[model samples]
Target: MSTTPRIEVAAVADALYGKWKEERLAGRALASDPRLQTIPGQSMDEHRERVLEQLGLLVEAGAIQRAFPKHLGGSDNHGGNIAGFQELVFADPSMQIKSGVQWGLFGAAILHLGTEHHHNTWLPDVMSLKLPGAFAMTEIGHGSDVASVGTTATYDPETEEFVIHTPFKGAWKEFLGNAALHGQAAVVFAQLITNGVNHGVHAFMVPIRTPDGQMMPGIGSEDDGVKGGLNGIDNGRLHFTNVRIPRTNLLNRYGDVAADGTYSSHIESPGRRFFTMIGTLVQGRVSLDGAAVNAMKGALAIALRYGSERRQFSGADGKEVVLLDYGHYQRRLLPRLAETYAMQFADHKLLETFDEVFSGANDTDENREDLETLAAALKPLSTWAALDTLQEAREATGGAGFIAKNRLTGWRADLDIYVTFEGDNNVLLQLVGKRLLTEYAEQFKDGDVAAIAKVVAGQIGEGAARFGLRQMGQSIADLGKVARSVEGVRDPETQQALLADRVQTMVAQIAM
Candidate 1:
């Protein structure tokens, strides 16, 4: 007789879900809050305002301040804060993304990139939602190419302020959350010019609107209108024409300017300094990784429960079998379930590493680079996985999933843009490829020429393996007899070797 596999599901769930106890509890409470529930049939404008109200509720619950400094009435619990924030996807994706824009990007720019003066002056209003803002980094012309932005912040020595301007239409800050209507200020990124010399890119806190909702002079914006998803956010574009702010407005953790218009950075290389400033914003990607995983979990929970209780056809015993009992249905969900469990463990590890780096426990250049690379790699996978899983879950549920109240379609729609945000998936993969090559080159720096040549040959072999040319060659040598393809594919050792070999080959090709 055959026996089923024995596993401790509760133990595994607790292990994966209990990493940040207090934060997870807060998330669960928020998920269950009746006031935060999504209202069916609400218009786009109503949804946007509803999400804003939900943000206020999050502030009242003290759930959004955990990641800020402890002196500013926050817990300074970076990892826990992300863990809690990601879980809000369960309540409503629009609300989750809107809150992320408010705190993770806008507020985080001030907290992570700016100094104590900024923290003391702005964080209180930010944490309390008294001052809504946007993180305006992406430009119409320079989406992923942040370093080449055309917006300029020219230092004026006579006035001791920086004049911010969009040199052309493409230079306008585009697709900024909270920018269309709600944002009163923004952390605008522009190329810094001082003493007639360019200093790469830096962030400046610019007030865009007054408390009464009127645009400030020299600042103009237009609403993005209805988007395909995440309509709860007031996405918009911003343009500046000689908008001047005090020189002290620069978030100068990495680069600074003097009263005499002398620009200096602690890191001598402008390229390195720019990267360091951008690295501080890695928390956005980290939080997205966790959120994608949880979204997969939420969708799976609904689908699997419905499948177990649902029956379609009658069996030999004159009773209908549960939908999950069908082999095709099992194939659709069981593998996904296994992958989701793996992602849960992987996401927890990523969150822990993020906390270690941000909390100053393991802060180092190598660790930060590792954290950034891991986030880049994992966010793409998890977000892609989420969209795929939600789509499959929707199909599996048949007409039930189509109903708006079931949330499958909503989940899929809200998550679609995740592939394009924080960092575009393709762009992020390119970063990973570059980093791998850099590390690989460093390892062989002192090696013999013969050894390096041998490594190059081995990489070629990997590429050859991917093409199945080796198998064809063996078949020719064997006089039309080839090895069993299924047997080779089923071998675990062979599968691992094939995957590793293929990845190495792709990276090598990209490097060339």
Candidate 2:
């Protein structure tokens, strides 16, 4: 904490929090609108039709344009934009994700990672949905391993263009949210090679579908017709057969290929340069973090309210019992309720840090790293929680929940895909785990092994104090039995430290 005024934070939080309420209202508008709701067992064409229609509704409502530049007539307030954008999950996750494919991934790739020249060249159409786009990063064989993607963007000095090609099937981009149908363009990522030097992965704007809905000459696509869920999205695959675009097509805020085809960049180290490029696109994870939390709240509000009203087996009064009155019911729901409350606070903190870094209030490299770690941490937790909460809510409502009429079953089915998008939950958590190890390893990088050992030993002693002195090894202990300091460990900051510490602890224990 800097010595910033408490009132400043609260005032900002109040305004942003109200945006979430407005987002909820947006959800209600869509849910009642019928045009946006998902129909069960809908065919691929029907799904595509509904998805395109809903995306148009979202654009017409101005719900999908919140994150653009004010010079371009957007609000340009980063925090408020995300707050409102996240509520789209309630109507349909497919709509939310396909909208994200167009705006958050594609438009943001231009807004954040592109130069003003690139923005002026392409963003007007992209922002207006006239150039609806795909984020073509996840390839068929390289889902999480972006660096290993075989799609190549080789510079051609003769044409002053970058020749991008998918020479192998494994290099073809897959599972793209809008590739099959509506996308007119894509923010394509390929390994950038210029002057015989590999410059790591970078983004390029590629026109895929023509304005008349035909695939472009060098681009080929196949629809991933039906999915386990999120069937409303036209998930598809893309292959480029020597697609050529102007060298200026590279979204080169982080790295550039000059007219001479020599690679140059602001960040020196390839590792740092790669992370910087990817970090620019991290609003994907950031939005997912907030959306997952909102989804959980939706699940809980519906289930808890319904659970309270829903009557179960008969009681002595010859009336059915409220489902929530059962201990088993509370046992199933309360822990998730606790998780949702805690995660809402965590989401706010993540949003504050995101605004701080992106708004340049705290744009230090350290702050950016912190923001990424916070996103990686909270995103995994919230997505997994959303899936778990939705499942529990579905079961809690019994067959009524299973029906589409009540919305629980549909919400459950839709949210199933969230755990896999933005990044898989397991993969995101593993990234967090790696970051934690690096943080701990830094403690000893200054030739101060004793200090690192002492720090680790000190933490172990504290853990022992809480477990041994506080609990006395008993099967049960009162919640108040521990010292206030020990219990303060439950605070979010303390929880963050322990989670990091546990990662370090596991690494250390493994090494020993």
Candidate 3:
């Protein structure tokens, strides 16, 4: 065996993880926070309370305030904020997720989509955990599709307030963290109607609870009890019935209403305006992508450590072989390890791109679109990989991995819903596929006859080559020609080209 194919492990790990990310990892407050430590045999209710307390601890340590404007008591470090946020999985998935719901989804919605008035009025309390809030976007009828939510916020010029209402049971905001217990307010998403003209979905600062933790007028909620996992999050559903809030409660960054109840927006196209509003909060997906990658790495670390210590069958010299030294064990873990590294690298790039857009350094329509597409693409891959890697790690560790003390199964179960959180995996990938097709079409739209012909011919040739290779592979396999089959597809370039061609062909067919 060749022993000359390795690089410096420490240096490689540092580079792959990114320097800022390494700093955040080294400086994690959760590492020393006694309150955030997991307790053995803790009840779900106890764990939920503990995790909520951990949010206050995080706020006290200023962990959740980094992404806010520097002028308003924050470091204004967007990328660093996400870098630190992702590392919380090392503490507990429930704590990480609940904190994410409070800060990333709820607080971030107001910060990004709301104007300065919303920020100055609400964000200080939000940052301090003095005002817990829910991101009321997902409804029973519309989790993946935000624009079709049945909740309505009708602007009333009579009182200069918006009347928010959930028309039916299915329109209730479902699976919302903080809505069950701690939330006093919510960045509620609803269709904005003014003067009989219904605008698309918009976020409003709606009060759900009073100072003494009682539900406000026209607000109803139910606790989602004893979920399969992530019970440390007090998930719940909320319904509104003719709830009226000040007209200024509307987070009007993208659109606004006049005192006369006239709706207006700088973005003329309703579709573009809606997308732009939604795109501003893509950091939730970006953070989830990195957090899922962190969970995968955590599981792999536990399994690898256990495997390196636990001896399996006897070796040639009558000494037992360590599980990690076996070829089968290596095969199972190494490929996934390599994949986690790849995802980490891609996630780092995604975080950087998100910061660039959000920091106003490269804020543009195209840049925002690119950031959103990158988030949609990478989130699905990392979350699905996390679940798969955790399962494999659990299996690799045998009985030890299944033990609750080891944390693998618990982490796996908690992460299971990540594939659906922020955005569902399949729906996100469909979004990515649509973006790909749209970009592909854009390339052909401005082309003259000659250029259009050239592109179409090229795509067809690529598809044909892919089809021919598959046919050749089939024929070789049918004749038992193993060597010829290997030769035909052995080149990495050939394999990649074939895969790309297949995907392109599929997208084209779907476009047609």
**Each prediction's Cα lDDT score?**
0.89, 0.80, 0.87
Model 1 Cα lDDT, one tens digit per residue, 462-483 = 5554534454455456664445
Over 1-512, each residue of candidate 3 has an lDDT whose tens digit, in order, gives 99788899989877766846554664355644657766646898999899998888888777878899887898888998888888887777788888888888889999989999998998888888889999999999999988999999999999999999999998999999999999999999999999999989999999999977899999999999888788888999999999999999999999999989999899999999988888888888998998899888888998899889999889999999999999999999999999999899899889889888988899898888889988999999999999999999999999988988788888888889989988899999999998998877876787688888876776565444455466656758786888767776766666776777777778877776
User: lDDT: which is higher, 2 or 3?
Assistant: 3
- Model 2 per-residue lDDT at 394: 83
Residue-by-residue lDDT tens digits, candidate 2, 1-512: 69865567777546446535665466557655777766666786887788888888887877766678767757766765676667777777777878888888989999988999987888878877888889999998998788889999999999999998998999999999889888888889899988888888889999898888999989999988777778877889999999899999999999888898888888999888888888977788888888888788888888899889988799899999998999999999999998987888788888778877877788899889989888888998888888889889888877777888676677677777777877788888888878877776777788787987776665565454433333332322544455644656556665665575566557766544
Q: Predictions ranked by lDDT, top down? A: 1, 3, 2
Ranking, TM-score, top scorer first: 3, 1, 2
Error of 3 at 465 (Å): 7.3
Q: Give me the candidate number with maximum lDDT.
A: 1
Which lDDT value does model 1 have at 482?
45
Residue 33 in candidate 3 has what lDDT? 65
TM-score each candidate.
Answer: 0.90, 0.88, 0.90
Regarding TM-score, does 1 or 2 come out ahead? Answer: 1
Per-residue lDDT value at 420 in model 2: 80
> In terms of TM-score, which candidate is stronger, 2 or 3?
3
| TM-score, predicted candidate 3 vs. hidden true structure | 0.90
